[model samples]
Target: MPIDGLLLNKLIREAQIFEGEKIRNIYQPVNDEVLLQLQSGFLLFVLKNPSYLIKLESKPNMPDTPQNFSMFLRKKIKNAKIIKIEQLGLDRIGYIELSVIDETFELRNYKLYFELMGRNSNILLIDEENKIMDALKKGVSPKRSIMPGAKYIPFYKREYINILENENLYDLNQPFMGFSKISKNLFYEYIEKYDYISFVSEFLDNLNVYTFEYNGKKEILAFKPVNFKYDEFQNPSEGLLNFFELQSMNSRFLELKKRLEKTVIKEIEKYERLYKKLKNEEKEIREIPDLEKKGRLLQAYLYQFKEKTDFVVVEDWETGEKIKINLNPLKTPNENLQVIFKKVHKLKSKEIHLKERIKITKKMIDYLYQLWQSIDFVEDIETLMEIKEEMIQEKILQDKTKNKRRKRSNSKPYEFEFNGFKIFVGKNNIQNDKITREADREDIWMHAQGIPGAHVIIKTNKKEVPMEVLLFGAKLAAKYSKGRYSSKVSIDYTMKKYVWKPKGSKPGMVLYNNFKTLYVEPI
Candidate 1:
């Protein structure tokens, strides 16, 4: 649930119990979470995240490791005594005053500010003069900036108010808070019934904390949500922790998955464009045959042609047909024929090279397509990371961050058993390379022909591979390819010996001959 002004007021009230406690230690378990261990049992929890921010009783597992910011906090005021805790009206601004004994035995006052302002929440350590010493998140904008050594500016929406001003219903509630929309709507009724300040205080004190499921989303509320039966939690913090965990698990993974997909799709588009260019260039090469015929005809009629400075009338020796041939005017009859012949030879030369180019380009497109297909089959974060690592290793993805935590996992193929025959399907290009090269020569290698797909190997162990096993392998290949949703897919299979990788070929590119094709509906 969104931590509106009302929730922050409640949390601030809970945090006041730690006012006299001595700060024993500080820890940053995660990048966005902060823990303060007090001499009293009451630990001060401050969470500063783009997602949500709240002050609560933290029951988080402390990491054995600590971040640099955590260590800085430990050194600054390890044994500092908390003098006071205050909530600045209903602006979602909070402050914790600390008294630290200086080196010379003089006492110094410092303040830690918690601005739980929705997605822009921040925590700042400040001196008596409000000069920022440090911040969990240092935000810089055209109008404001939070930087170390700079005088801190208190974040306020409207001109600073001396007291609660009833300019509007919202303005009145802004100094206090409402637990629900219904409660907020009743603000006018309460205002007429009792004094404004007393009514607000009563509302905050009367809120009952509980946990409930609403619209299939786990929510922790200070009041029982209106229409749904809820599981009651004596401790609001524990329920909120569970809700945050369950909510963020799917969200974080899905966010990473989308980023990975964007990277893959960008690369696939490039390869696809190259494939079309190569195909178009190969089409242009077809005109070479007609050009060659014209050159041959000119060669036969070289002596018969009378060069008219710009054009020549030539006779086809085979058909005795008269034809007009445009000449260079600056070259002899033999030189003219040689010029046209050279042009035809050049295009013909390109034909052989282009055929090889078209082959490789098609393979590259297929390789990228297979990589795209594998993303949907990734069951865990581990598998997704493996695919990302493969792309990075291939120089297809450039790491933008200096601090990328890479967990190296080996290329592991999907293993299956069909009729006692072990079948392995490569999930990505790296795995495809491994599966093909490591398999026995006689192992049946299957792939969706002319489609971007996985490489499937049936481990026959030199035994007579059954027809049923081949069909199974074909289906596996199709199921892992771009044609998985198609009505029919053609799969090709042959011995591993036929699938040979040439030097300088792309990771999953291979040449295969003597392969038979089989039609199968992708499973």
Candidate 2:
């Protein structure tokens, strides 16, 4: 749910400590967000959809080049002292009044207003006369204008009851201004099960803001909801900031997942198309043998052709069958025979080249499939970053983050323990290569047969592995493979000694022998 006026009330009360502080610095973290640096702390105003205002504990990363409004604010009120802060009648509009000395050494008064209404949110700098000097976003609405030199009009207030004074809590619907629907539902539900008057007394007297988890989502309010798991904070902004951070991280993770998936899918389609083209060429070249047979027949019947003709009928020496051969009427019989032989020789050479190309194309398709399947198992942004780095190294993606230095995380195989045995499964090609090449000579290695998948290793410590453990390893191999959705998948297993990497082969490409196969469903 978006931050409503009631929640803003709690935030403003906690932010009262900053009223006497001076604005030290201002930053525009993003196009829609602004940060106000002060002697005590930072105040962040998010002016995008689902906008909010929160007090930050530490300084956030700032853009190298400041935006127009941020630079304007810096020049106008760099060391302005905050004199007062107020909310407009439980509306989602808060303003901070400041006093600053100008170049003439005369005291000037200004106010910075933060309108936290979703989608229409904006921040404006207004003079003592309440004329807008500049705004983060400028526009003209039907009711008021937000452009420079226009009168600043606040949102119209609606009639609301003073809940603190009124004892009767019934008939509360959408009538109470600034109270969200979720808050009303929560209060009504609480009043049904417990003593309403006593609960209200305790909630109103409580100084801390509360965060609760309901239906797998985090919610913050002035009072904690009963029967829900909650975390308490002395400062209300902390709880709200934590919720916002988690929300932002989740959004970033999903966006990264989409972008990486799109890149991998593009590569997969390219290889698939190439594989199809190679197979088609191979099919055309397979007709080379038929052409060679025709050429030999023409050579034997060269003497039979006396005049230039377009067709000839001859009997096959081996099969005693009559066959028809088309002749080039303008050329001699011997020349026609020579032409057929030359065409056959050229086709024979092409056949060999096509076969080699077909083989290489097939391997590329398999490698791409492996990369595509690995994206589904990524649970966190860090793992996705590893995959992204691998793609960049392979030249599949551009190095967009080359200028930014980031710490490389050590990629590890997924480890599981069952029946006194440890099973390791590789999620990506790099991890697969690491596990297969680094496993002990006697340890067991497993992979799904005839499909792109993760490599699974069972740590035996040179001891004999049990059949149950082998089946466990096979299940993991199938589950992480491209055939994961199949009801039954074939898993091939062998000793690590029997597995060897081919010379100059791609990562995760290996040859194995003396292996056993088992059929099982993915777990």
Candidate 3:
């Protein structure tokens, strides 16, 4: 969870670190993480993709030299003393005003505004006249120009319910004292028990870190605890950092997943469009049979037409139909007959070829759809990377941003163990090809029948697996196939000796003959 407005307000209100401390230095460790060394304590600011985070942390080690934003902040407020810190009403914006003496011996005030809105969060340094000195995210948009020397624009102008006022809770679009939606119930409970001012003051003074952990799952919250037993930490910073790490991992995973989804979806659409065009072209070749009949008639009557002719009349022996055929004026009747035979042969060949082309295109569409399903069902980043690499190998995914060659990710097959027998599952085509080629001939191979998906193998060590382990492997095969969400999926299993990758064939495309099919619902 994010640090909400109420928790932030409470954190700042109770923190004694800012009372009279002077800013000694500032450092930007990465694009999103920042460190502020004050006279008495260290403050860490993480303003990555998820709004912004502020915590009184230990002095972190700087990884590199300061960047442009850090340099600008150091130049302006390096040695300035903190005069006041305040939150803008009940909004998520906070202000840290500084007092600095100019080179000419005059004291000046600079305001550093911290806006914690999701995705749109920004930090701006404003002068006394409200002109922006610099912004964390500098850009010019229709609504505002976030750059140096532009007038600072406040986040919003809506009327917010003051926590201390006698306001109706139902009319509020947001929490009166908190930022996240999770704080709503707690706020109502507090309001029911005590007056607004007393409740907020008490809540702020007694802030604690609450973490819920069950069955290897974990989540951290700022204050309110649920019915399930949880861990309470006296230090909120530790809780905040723990939660931040989890959120950062989730954010990165989501980013990669979205990019992969877009790539696969676009590829699927391309193949579908091709399939439609080919189907239409196949319609034009439907007259091949009639053309063949005409060619045979002209050949049968070739000797009778000894002179040149503009047209020919022939009678079909089977249907007793008279057909008038147009011919080239400059050519003899035999020449016209030869031309008709050649045309018939060409059309016959082309029709056969076009039908095959349509079949191949349709098959490609099915494979791309299966790949789409595989990507949608995967949850691991390693699996996604492997799938992306397979696409790159097949020329399905093109990276427009890459100008130089980069090394591939070090991903391998997913490993599982059941009944002391090792089970391996391929995450993508590349892994599937590798596993099938390198495994022992006696090992068992498993895959979803009639679907594109990961290949599962059980290491037999020259020993046959029992029904229990075989069923488990089949379950995994179905779970990773195109029928992952469907019931009664058929899975095929056989020894490694029965499965073979054809020479010069595409990756993950294999041939198998001695396989047994089993039906089961995927786990």
Candidate 4:
């Protein structure tokens, strides 16, 4: 839910908990978000769509290279202590009064204003005289100038009565300052269900905010949401942070999924082109024998062709058939024979090189396809991060960080319980390697046969594995495979002892013996 003036008012009041806290650090995690690490906790001001400010419980990840606005804020108020935090006239505008030591070794006062109007939201730094120093977004408009050196103009005021001060005279049809449309509607519902006096008393005394599901989506309001189960919080800031952080995580997950899919698809196209070219070169190997035969024919007929000519007729020694050999008229017959021998030698060498290239290219195409299919199985941002980290390690994508060491992910395999057997399915190549390596010798292993797919393992505990459980595992393997949409998929299964990863092979690639195939529909 978008933050209205009332929500911003509640947020500003809750922000007072960190009034005297010193600024420990500052960061711009993305272009639209800024995180303030206070001595007490982390404060974030998101200035993009659905903008709001809250005190986070922990610090979020920071980019290695800071944005220009973040750099400016860090230089100006890295260690500044908050003098005060206030909301302007119950509007969606908030300012933090901070004091920091200037270059002259004296304390200077500055205000950071957070304008939380969607699409027009901005965080600006103001001097004591209220002149704009810099803004998160610099712009020029007819009503206001958000550029440096321009005077800071607060948003146009609307004459709405304060509901707390004039609750008896306030009408639902008239504007109530700071109250959102939802809040206004809730006020009418409350007055109709109960009485105005009790509603006013509760509104003034309420210190907690509630969050609930409405229309299958989460929403937060100052008053208790009607006809829904809700979670209550004494502090509004924490509630807002928890609710929005979850939304942010889901949004970030979807964005990363689309980006990874695009990257993998692009890589697949590139490798497919390379694969086709290499295959075409492989066709040239078929001409090697013909070139050697031509060289031999030229050697035998070297004396018969005395004059410079483009063609010479000869008899094939092996087939006893007449053959015409094309020659380069600029050279002698021996020179032509030498050229044919050179052509034959070059083709032979290229044939060896082409074979290796074709093999590697086809493998790459298969790997990229696997990564593409694996993206659909990703359930969280951490899984996407793991996939992205894998790409960076493989040099398929460049690492955006500046020489920063990435922490290794410990993402576990997806687990399912069926018919008293525990089935573990790998989500990505790394997990595939882990699942197979860690399984017991007698545990059943399964995969989609002749296709890029997840590795499935059933922990047998040295018990006799049932046929039904094996079929269940096979269904899972097919579901996660590239052939997921097929009516039926072939799944190969064997004991863990019979499956072995080949030396110098790619991740998730393995060779197996004593395997049985099962044809089953994807689960």
Candidate 5:
């Protein structure tokens, strides 16, 4: 419903007058409005910093201090005691007398000569000098117009009320024919101040008393005022009682107003928390590319090492036979190390992704709680469904349809040929298992000591293995292990017969004796 001027006037008429009330507190919720708590037994709210409007409502207790708009009112009208008040213009305007110090001042006046022009809505307070003491709202300072220092001429004309003083009871049943307007429009224009139900009730009563009819049917039958005895209307229909109940129920709409206010507060808190979490996660995700670049450099280094052309020395364990195996860089140490580090980087990226997912989950929890509190009907299940869809879109809730079956590709164990001998290095778990169980007893096995690293082996086919190739394989072992970045890593080498895996040892873990420790830093 539109808040008409008449309704505001009616409210002012009903407000209790405070003759000697003091301005105890004031609050300014916005630039254009002020709420004043007076020492009088009323809570007064003054609106329109641009136009003059004062509203008063009763409260059980007065506030100790001003809040929001009340603070501004105290500053403007300090220590002024109210003396007298007069209602004018059908209670629309109120003029007040005040006693300030020893001077009897008549300061408070509500008949503001105000104008709302486009974006410039201003309320000018003009004194006898035609000088504006202050304005509730400010307009643009024009070069040619009266401003802060200039003489004030009325910027706009004031509205005057014209009352129909001659109309009497006889005029009420004349179908308002003098206006030459539609009956509905005329009735509305005359009785528009009342609410819809009240207007309908009053109009019907007038029709019944006047024997007025529309299309040969009576529109109104009876009138029922707030204090009317409903039981006296014998044989009342259910329809009439239901209509009365609807009107009565509307008086309690203030409960819904309170619920709306509480919902707004909860939504504000939820949004703030979600925004903070997303901001932090965004910062973390931005660092992932840099880590990926580091992984690329490490992969390139291992690739180059595996591409060296040499004969790998291999030692047969059972027959003590040694032979030379030619090494192919693409299928040897370079390829194996590249694959191992790639898996490591992938695992690290997954960890970061999981962390981000957890953050989103927490935000969703807050959002759901807020949603539940704000909405009235649980039957509208679409809101919950929308939240689920959002989670899936953000990848917080994984989409099973997007999970593709991946074929596992195996990288053969690391091996290279140097000086007519065979050598082998294990890159990862599956490859380590294969290399350890398949190598001959005569082959020399090597691994980083007391560290979880790659397995290295040198084949001796009845020919003694070269020390340089053995050292190179040992260094490659250390480079691929958990201690790859350490200053010096220990690598033990022995015949394949001496190196053995226990029943269920983790890949690349083996027990060995008759081994030599080689301390090497991987190039």
Candidate 6:
């Protein structure tokens, strides 16, 4: 599940609890990942360098962090004093004030900020110097906004306040008028913002005493009123009323709050560890080009070492062509070396992609969790399929089909009409080939430039194509291609007659002349 608002609230509460604590030690486990130890008596509260993000994380593993950012954190803000901490209203924005001295004899105040990790992680540090020390995000700047050098500006506008702080639980039974109007969205909104569902539930359970129930032969509807009784012991016969009594007597609210806080802390720790591991693994993988060269050198050495008698002549099976094949008794050492090299290369590539996938997957999971917490929607197979397909397109998951082509039907092709023009998109390579061959010369054809993407054709029917229709076709082509969601993609468009598939070009590979390059960003 995505990290809910409750988890964030709990983290904020914990941060508040350790607000004025003195910094004991600070160290970076990986490049950007800084660990801050705050001493509150004997217990230490560790606030991870907020700049480092937990990209991909598993339950039993550490999350991955970006390399350059981690390095930046290690270089700067090492063992800096955390002066003051403040929560940004009810949202997941938390500001940690830090004090650091530069080369000149002067104390500089910096605010280390943390926003929730979503589509982007927006943790940043801004100093009194009015310069950006660093940011978890490299995107966006104060200059982009109207307010420049604003000390306390949030990354995004604050929309709502903490629900608990807004609602008065003390005067629960005042009128009960507002209580009945609370919808599921409001209930979940409160649940997300205040990590204290047990408290809310307990409060409601106690307030059930003033609840009204109506009975009828038809469908029976019930409305509950909020009631709070500070004094006088009531009978424990009422169902929800008794629950409140037990909750009050056992003082489980405090326990639940503690549990929630611990869970948030543990999640933060897990993310921190995963971020460190991923960063290190990525560093290792980035060294593969050098490793590949070394492997090639080793292969050359092994090949020469067994050149005397170990090599043998072999004939090709197709034509009985003679070829020198290494047949060392100890096995073709060079061939074996090449095999190992290939395996290493594959492993390195896989490791990098896997890390990226895991990171994206974690983000998606966190998103789903948050959505689930806010809504009572059941995640079905269709949603999972869409998510899987998205992941595959993102290269987070390997496409199982690879280069395989599906058989196409010989029946009439499916077509869509938009803006008084027929739009035909190929279902597969065979269909694409048929469409290109059979379509009128005047029809406009479009394809993703220099990539194995879909075939899109706009049936212009010997008429001048409208600019809007051309753009529509281009957008659709870009949207379906590998470059979909990218900032800019080049799409090639031309007359259908000018498009031809090369004799042995792979499926979806085609040559086109008199084509126009359309620079477009997909919708």
Looking at candidate 5, the ten consecutive residues that score lowest on lDDT are: 220-229
Per-residue lDDT of candidate 5, residues 1-523 (tens digit) = 1112232233333333566686555555455544445675443333432123343444434456545324433544556565545334422334444444423455543222333232344444344455655555544455334455556554322333212222332334333211212333434444544544554444323312111233543221222222222332221222223333443444333343344335445554665676667566556556556445434443444433444544444443435555344434556655544554565566566666666666555544543333333232212223223333333444434556567753334445556877777777664444565787888888787877765566677778756777787778787877766667898888888888997776643333457898888888974
lDDT of each: 0.73, 0.83, 0.76, 0.85, 0.48, 0.51
Could you tell me the lDDT of residue 393 within candidate 1? 72
Predicted structure 2, TM vs. truth: 0.84
Candidate 4 TM-score, C-alpha based: 0.76
**Full candidate order by lDDT, most accurate first:** 4, 2, 3, 1, 6, 5
For residues 1-523, write the lDDT of model 1, one tens digit per residue: 5655555555565666778889888887677767787765445444544233334444467788888877877877788999998876666677889999866788889998877765577778899887999988886887778999988887865443322444355464453332345435444455656656865455466434556665676666554444557765444445555667767776766777788788879988988888788788777688777667778877766667655466777676668888777778887777877888887777777888888887777776666766777776666665677888877876878866549776587747899998989999987777888999999999999988887788899999889988888888888899998888998999999999899998877667677999999999887
What TM-score does prediction 3 earn? Answer: 0.68
Off by over 4 Å in 3: 10-50, 55-79, 84-91, 115-176, 187-208, 211-220, 224-244, 272-313, 316-320, 324-363, 400-422, 485-487, 521-523
Instruction: Report the C-alpha lDDT of model 4 over 121-204, residue by residue, as the tens digit.
Output: 899999989999999999899999999999999884658776656656445588777777777787677677777777667755
RMSD list, candidates in order: 8.9, 4.1, 6.7, 5.3, 28.6, 25.3
What tens digits encode model 3's per-residue C-alpha lDDT throughout 278-304?
777666467567767777888887777
TM-score ranking, high to low = 2, 4, 3, 1, 5, 6
Q: For candidate 2, give the lDDT of residue 26.
A: 90
Task: List the candidate 5 regions with Cα displacement exceeding 4 Å.
Answer: 19-31, 36-39, 46-76, 79-99, 102-130, 141-161, 164-336, 339-523
Reference-based lDDT, residue 442, model 1: 94
By summed lDDT, which 10 consecutive residues of candidate 2 come out lowest? 156-165
How many clashes show up per model? 0, 0, 0, 0, 36, 12
Task: Return the TM-score for each candidate structure.
Answer: 0.58, 0.84, 0.68, 0.76, 0.33, 0.29
- Collision pairs in model 2: none
Model 2 stretches with alpha carbons more than 4 Å out? 103-106, 160-168, 190-212, 289-352, 403-406
> Which candidate number has the best lDDT?
4
